[model samples]
Target: MSGKDTGHGTQRLALPGVFTAEQAAVTAAAIAGIQRADGAIPWFRGHHLDPWDHIEAAMALDAAGDHRRAAAAYHWLARHQLPDGSWYAAYADGDATRPTDRGKETNFCAYVAAGVLHHYLATGDEEFRERMWPVVYAAVEFVLELQREGGEIGWRRDPDGSACDGALLTGCSSIHQALRCALALAELRDDPQPDWELATGRLGHALRHHPECFLDKSSYSMDWYYPVLAGALRGAAGRARIEDRWPEFVVEGLGVRCVSTNPWVTGGESAELALALWAVGDSERAARVLRWIGHLRAPDGLYWTGYVYADEAIWPRERTAWTAGSVLLAVAALTGDEATGAVFGGAGLPRGLEAEECCDRS
Candidate 1:
């Protein structure tokens, strides 16, 4: 609320014990420092921009009470949206808006809806929501255009416009959550997208039952937990899913591993798992998981990407906006930020149209 007007009334983000007010402010400042004048937030100051991470950082900025900047970040996305409603996989360096990776990632395209809705929820910014609706709607169309008949969305589209043959568990799960947010936006506008709802329900079915549709990536922590975090799986089933992979992905007294074979425990993944845990009504476990990652926090309140257990050091010394952003989001969810809580805990967001059947065997 302290920030300049973005044509929408200003409102501050919720601050809870997820981190002290001081620590939260410090993290916010750190994030703000990396935001480009054009509103692009790269992974690090000199690093490239991925749309998903860019939005993550923007959300953190919003949580930190930098409302105008957060709104600017969304505007950046709207300004740069490709003709096809997608963005290149990566935009290199803040110095220019060039794409480092020209591939259009499916989940990355879909994520804009989640970001737009979260911003609207936090600020009650009707104008912001209205302006960004076309961007969100187009991004959703781009994502679902690649969804297969079996209900799994293809993972990416190459520069030449060919879709990737296989789906990814993590990416598809995230898209499921994004699709729900898109539905919520559509409903809010009184312009329901039945196709989106059906696609979402089908995508959810694929995420929960058709593992075969996605490339097998059991070793990666994201594949193990994102379904729960993304709301594709919930209740006892969700809790059981995390328990099923707990031993493989979580490092006791440390944090969640980036991969089963790696000695690395990543702050982003760990914080995300904490959010997932909270979504399933396991707040205590979520807090413990989040606390374990404090080891990855830098003196400046910025979080390191991961800690390498074998090296006994932060493997990637660089502080990433997304890593800090994940922590802020997890804390927001824990501290009861209604929008953050609703997004992560799968409340308030549309649940999508239930598929006629759970799984399409064909």
Candidate 2:
């Protein structure tokens, strides 16, 4: 299948075996409808925006060939950056918005690197990359400021600017991917951030070998699968990790559970798990995982956040742009989009700084 023209001034890319062209167009339109005039995409039409999810939605726009809107989303983030290069945890939904949450999360701050690089990769937009460099740089700096001696990153900073002491395995894993993307962006710009390289190496090391350094959120599916998705573990180790926890988190025909104990299967996690599976060369399983979430798709092509098996209903009753964003990302990865493939499959992203003394000196 080929790309199709959407009325929304974008071409919807088709991903056979994952999503049909019509489905992709519908999803793209759904995302477009929820995007604010300023290009910020909220969780839903009337919800708040978080940096991580906002970037996910923006990348979806890029995947759908809505470059202008994607660029607008990046600009929104750039415009709202704090002096320390971080954003408030959440913002109110609309034009007359205020910060709904004031805490700044390290992973959320760092994810702009991945988003900016994803946009650059998809569009090959040097000018856009140049424009976003400082935004990515400052955000990465803010995140690394929280890195500890043990290599795990502190999770969040309160509104008062005090850092939290603990870290999350999933969050650090996600940040590891962002660090790699940051390095890739630096490479594109003929800039070298040696400190970022070292930080990436240490962060990857902590994620792969030092679970003791992060908070125990083992019951969550993200903590189980994120290392693979983030490229911190690859090949045999990545395969083993996913297999080890498969029965615990996956719900077969339903989808991946948000948490092991919950009777809930979420669209976002399931789609991400599909991407993680694709990262490890398990395309068969990835396809299956993506297909399983078809149950969550609404008539308008937006996806319900999750299904509560206990109640047999959509748990949150909200159709989120990010959830649709995840589906588009997974589709892009599976359908051989080079940029999305690289970001998710570790094709050309930085391998993180090595832990040797030579790396530190360099």
Best by TM-score: 2
Task: Please provide, for model 2 over 88-181, each residue's C-alpha lDDT reduced to its tens digit, 9 standing for 90 to 100.
Answer: 8998893325988999999999999999998888778888889899999999999999999988999999999899889999999999999999
Segments in model 2 whose C-alpha atoms lie over 4 Å from true places: 1-17, 94-97, 357-362
For residues 1-362, could you state the per-residue lDDT of candidate 1 as single tens digits?
A: 22443222212323333466767777888887888989889998778999999999988777666788899889999999999999998988743457889999999999999899888888898889999999999999999999999899999999888987899999999999999989989989999798888898888877888889989888999998899999988999999999998998999989999999999999999999999999999988888888888888898879989999998988887999999999988887877778788778876778776775433423
* Residue clash pairs of candidate 1: none
Worst ten in a row by lDDT for model 2: 1-10
Clashes of each: 0, 0
Backbone clash pairs for candidate 2 read none
| Cα error of candidate 2 at position 345, Å | 1.4
